[model samples]
Target: MSERKPVVLVTAADLAPEALALLGGYEIVYAGKTPSDDDIVSLCGQHDPAAIIVRYGKVGAAAMAAAPSLRVISKHGSGTDTIDKTAAAARGIAVRAAAGANAAAVAEHALALMLACAKSVPLLDARMRAGHWDKAVHKSLELHGRTVGLVGLGAIGLRFARMADAMGMNVLGFDPYAKELPSFVQRADLDTLWKQADVISLHCPLTEENRNLLDAKTLARCKRGVIVVNTARGGLIDEAALLEAVRGGQVRAAGLDSFAVEPMLAGHPFQKESGFILSPHIGGVTSDAYVNMGLAAARNVRGVIEAR
Candidate 1:
């Protein structure tokens, strides 16, 4: 008799057929919708999966404690902020992330946001639809001669740097963790980058040290009329300070995909503020990104399961 293949539990949304097919003959268990902590614990108590694929939901201590058979966790994307890494490590569960899969798509989305902000695309479209020509609304700034400061020169940040450089923008990067700077990017201290950049793009993770990294003091350091783009974590920028900067003309425009509070509450400042381009955390929502991330996560889970 053949040995039974280990079961893999998917706690997130259903994956594409292509992603599922990549798992070969592994037993797949789909946990329909995200269950509460108690429900997750109870369900796992019964179904004891060998591996769990997680996305967009918290997997707490209760759930982990319930699944003694779980050996690996494959996160669907780069950010493991939602996952309790320390607890997982203590439990001897290997945690894996599809880090590089969505870099290009996210970088492209950042550029798109910058372009839309620079051209005031949303405002223009809204006015034209309201039967206002508004032709004399002054010309928008060109990106050709601007300096782009990037925070965190990781995969997504480097990609954004390359794109900005290709568009004739001087690229400056600040990442204390990076051992060496990319050839196309100039390395700068955080203070210098903050003061000199015409456009600043954030691509760092959320951590205690980086939380509210761009508070009132940092905003004051930025060049007046600087454009800011944040496709990274929301906590990196102080939301209230960001709003104050925009209102006070310290920041000319901001392109934001993530917010301090996601699914941004109705009547948020971003909605009321002019020259602010907001996207609903769609930086990595492109079809290409979705396939890459889903497939990579599936493969990681499969590899770990088979190895064990």
Candidate 2:
């Protein structure tokens, strides 16, 4: 009888073919799209996977406990906030992330959001479709010579900063952990950045200390008509406060990719607000990023499991 190959579970319905080829020695099990926590737990219990390549669902203590043989949890993308790192550490399960794998893709998306907000692209498109051309009265904000403040200076943030700099915009950054930044990026405190910036983009992770970082108080401090862009996590901003700011014209526009809730439900208030631009969290959904992230995740999984 042939020995059974170790199981490798993927949280998504599919993976890039190249990535799958890299893990050809293992038995791959997919948990399907839009997997719930219970679905992950159930899959873990059934497969006893040696490693999990996280792509969709949250992996908590219960799911970790279900798979006694689990040795590693590799994130398919940069953010690992969905994984319970503390729990994984307690069980000696290593957690890894494919850092920078989707940097270009996400950074580009952030820039696109920023441009969309500044130009009111969606609103104008809708107007054009409705046979109304307000070219004489409509004015678009020019990005040149403007100051752009970025909350994070990681791979994605840095990439965005470069793009903004190329567009003749001054870049202010606010990441304490980042060091020896490029000459184009001037380090600034959050307060100073908020007060001076014409455009503010968030690329930081969501943490307890920074949750709702852009709440009513902070929003009040920003320059009126400042363009806001967030390609990072959603919990960083207070949705209600942002909505109010938009309604009152305290915020000129906001372009958001991620939401506090995944698959932002139908009839969400943002849907009706013309001041808001929304994307379905597809910042890193490009074909190139998919392969890059998958390969990175596969290697991380192999690095842990193959070593044992």
TM-scores, one per candidate: 0.93, 0.99
- Alpha-carbon lDDT of model 2: 0.96
Q: Can you give the lDDT of residue 133 in candidate 2?
A: 90
Please identify model 1 stretches exceeding 4 Å from their true place.
1-5, 33-42
Among all candidates shown, the one with the greatest TM-score: 2
> What RMSD does each model have against the real structure?
2.0, 0.8
**What is the C-alpha local distance difference test score of each model?**
0.86, 0.96
- The candidate maximizing lDDT is 2
Q: What is the lDDT of candidate 1?
A: 0.86
Give the 10-residue window scoring lowest on summed lDDT in candidate 2.
299-308
Q: Which stretches of candidate 2 lie over 4 Å from their true place?
A: none
User: lDDT score, residue 44, model 2?
Assistant: 99
